[model samples]
Target: MTRDDLAGMLGEQTTACGPARDALMAGGDFVVWDGPVPAGQLARTYRMRLRRTQRRGQPTLALAATVDRLLEAEEELLRIGQIVAADSSWTFMLFLNAAATEVLACTGVARIGTCPWTWCA
Candidate 1:
């Protein structure tokens, strides 16, 4: 779907905390990726990589830092993309800088079940 489409969808969603759509839109244009791999799988793969790096004592990926911010709500993040499964079982939202170069965070939403993966890069 296009950015405008996604924005409209987000706008329709309501929350007790506030207008999540505003927070989501503040990041500028949204980018959507079409691929064979599902979002959950992608997140799992990235998480595995992160574990490997942590085991080796290497600096974590930027995505990990972004995920930390997501958990802590340290700062408002920019929304950049969305990854939805073909069966509509799950969706993953990608966040990054306004320029859309560096990825800031990725969060997944599951329709039929709970999603356990949230990865960043």
Candidate 2:
């Protein structure tokens, strides 16, 4: 999927530091590698290198937790894809429900205002 597609999936306007977008940029890098035998089951491995920010004071941490949520959401999407392959009648609705469930369950902040990503930005 394209950067726009991933942004839409996450329900956020993909930030400048987004892993998908970074992977597409010139000389940019983002990757997820399989963990070694020892930590394989419990570890979710990912690496992303973003440009250094030149902000005026201490930069607040943002999106670290969100990344984990998105990863879980991705796994849910894969499962839904397999189900859709087997039974296509209710594909659209099933996919939508799966996506919504994943996003809601993984969201760190409570739903009180706008999208939590807005706060991160």
Candidate 3:
């Protein structure tokens, strides 16, 4: 996916993950993890991409703004998955793209209506 596509999927632009996002935006090669792992697991490593964008210091000025935009984009991407995605990959991708564990936790709570931490599995 392109940076704009990821941004659109994530909701807003990122200041930290800018370079990676820019890479994707500019049509750079990317490797998507599309295995059977749950959303939580899938997102663990990918969020680093967002962090890097802020460190790059040009496009996405503040990590907060970048985070805000990413959350919105994630919501949008999940909503879209209600149709196009035949498997968990779509949600997995966004979950992976998310900036923080809190975002994913909130998303899980929204999905299950309970704190995931309280669950045994």
Clashes of each: 3, 0, 17
Give one digit per residue, the lDDT tens place, for model 3 in 20-61: 333344444333333333333223332453444335432222
Candidate 1 residue pairs in clash (backbone atoms < 3 Å)? 31-80, 63-120, 63-121
The top-ranked prediction according to TM-score is 1
Ranking of models by lDDT = 1, 3, 2
Q: What is the Cα-based TM-score of model 1?
A: 0.34
Ranking by TM-score: 1, 3, 2
Every model's TM-score: 0.34, 0.22, 0.26
Deviation from native of the Cα of residue 76 in model 1, angstroms: 6.0
Better of 1 and 3 by TM-score: 1
Cα lDDT of candidate 1 equals: 0.43
Off by over 4 Å in 1: 1-67, 71-77, 113-121
Error of 3 at 47 (Å): 11
Model 3 ranges off by over 4 Å: 1-4, 10-14, 39-121
In candidate 3, how many Å is residue 48 off?
A: 12
Write down the worst ten-residue block by lDDT for model 3: 79-88
lDDT of 1 at 55: 61
Worst 10 residues of 1 by lDDT: 11-20
